[model samples]
Target: MLLHVSPARVGFFRAQLDTGRSGLVLCGPKSLQQARRLRNTEHFSGPLLVDPAVYEVRAASGEEPFPDVAEGTFGFEDPLAVSLAEQRAVGVTAPMTPTGYLHAEDSDALKAAVRRVAALDDPQVVFAAPVDVGWLREEDSVRQLIACLRLVRGPKALMLGGQRDPLAQHPRAVDHLRQIVTEVPGAALLRTDLAAFGALAAGAAFTAFGAGSRLRHIVAPGERAEKSKGFAQSPHVLFPELMDFFLGKTLADRFAGTAAPVCGCAACEGIRALDSFASNAGDRQARAAAHNVAVLMEWLRTLTALDSGPARQWWWYERCVAAVAQYPLLNAQLLQPNGFKVPAQLKRWALAAPAAVTVQPRADAKDYGRS
Candidate 1:
């Protein structure tokens, strides 16, 4: 399966070589240079997906889009910085939304960005990670964005992030997102975030991981080898410990699925469970990051190895039962065979506001917030 790594750079190539992976994910402004360097490096050969920056909503309460450099966004001056190198290396460019930049209201702006990006070079895949449940609920704008995306990048261009925790938000939000999934006419990357996997158990095109856990860890523990958050509360909810467990569970369950599993990466083959991941070599934070990476690789592998077969027959029955025992009503609908649906009230809430047109700059241009 394709193994999409993160942060395009010479170091990323080293990570690929170290792990013997064939797919890479390039993020931030340096993605282009990183992709090129990998092509030049004899140690590796693989395709690269570039996430220029992530765009997502700031809070769950309101419908607003903001630029979160902490979540990672390439700088304005270096928009095409990665383009020249990608051309030279004959590498692919897949612009992904940063951690918190994708808002439904930005559909028009997103389209414009896509158009500008597409003009630079014909990327292997044109993708966006729409994690904002707020935007997904806006049927008109979302459909419009989807149509435009399909037209620009064809059927496989758009990739939307799926439900993480169906129980975390109101029932209306869940329903709206599912409806958004049904209406969109492009490939999807169902990040099994917030126990939303059961909802996607039947026919998901792809899967991804939310940065909640990683983002949390960066702030909660200040564990960066050379980087630091400079002492600020992390907006991400996932705790490192929690991230380890969820990630491990997701992989082990999928590895032996009816649909032939795809991810081929170092972390997947190593760690077995979240607890095991937490103790698997290195410091506590290292193990946590490792676990997160492992699950992400597994997802990449699954997407790359998509095939015709029954979807993975999930067997987390016991864990699911326990979850139901605690969150019965919510879990019942989310895990129901028919899948969950967003309520009218939540739909109204999601559509309450529109996206603004102020292009703000990012903070970390050099390391995409790593530094």
Candidate 2:
């Protein structure tokens, strides 16, 4: 499991690191300063990925500006220079090559970015592509991406970023990810949510979810900004049993009940109902985010403990099936029929075929050079 670090929740993430449960920690351009502190600490020895977040630059220049892209955050015209410098400053030994969201039709741009990264001479370089989500819907595009990825000659990893929530929107997103990972080997889904679990079951090396809802998906360029409607932003609390997140206010208003489920994660200890997370008490948001991470990490541990690929896939399928089953029970508990809309990704996960075992041994990074 990969945890995307947010600057505000650095302390919470630091606490998580103390548990030694972290796999890969991803930090964005804005969080690099905090990530530097984490990297210099004794507790966090795991690999840290400092994402240049080139997609934000693309978004800011598009029809609808991404609100999150603060002016002058990525001041440089070339994101690669900024990316390499940031990684170096943070002491990332093997930095990822930063690239913007590639349109499927722009094969030349895709090939150029791939070749550019490959030429960087980093033996363990990661080729990161922030792609348009539509790529998954086009077979020719998927094939084009896979073919380009195969051209990397040395030890490398692939990090895929998509515009919006592809797993929820695209019917075959999971299968397409499986196919890509099968051909590309070391691939990770970036800026995703619970769908990352589906990618894991589909044979991805690991996947990342941001600490907050806004960071969960890449909002498409030209998309209108959502109106706040005078309500303060609330934390998105994950209900692990249901494999989904609920806004804190929504949980309190609708799901709070004597029979409401409780989380057993360390962060949630002593909390009677998950709805209690809705309270805006001191550190509630941070604590709630911690609970989300803890529960997901626990599930990751359970999945990884299984002996074979088929066993892991079966376990994931069963988990999805069980989560889906809870929708009706939750509706019944709330006395509101059809309160919860089952996520399409969750349903697809339940019906997914067992993945074939194709774990490949990673080549040692003997030399940080592009072959």
Q: Name the top TM-score candidate.
A: 2
Off by over 4 Å in 1: 1-22, 54-90, 93-102, 110-131, 138-141, 155-167, 170-185, 190-207, 210-282, 292-310, 313-371
lDDT (Cα) of model 1:
0.37
What TM-scores do the predictions have?
0.48, 0.83
| Candidate 1: tens digits of C-alpha lDDT, residues 30-135 | 6566666666665345445554443322311122222333425555534244433434454653444332334446564565555544554444444454434445
| Cα RMSD, each candidate | 14.1, 7.4
Highest lDDT scorer: 2
Per-model clash counts, in order, read: 24, 3
In terms of lDDT, the poorest run of 10 residues in model 2 is 362-371
TM-score quality measure for candidate 2: 0.83
Q: lDDT of all predictions, in order shown?
A: 0.37, 0.64
Q: Cα lDDT for residue 351, model 1?
A: 38
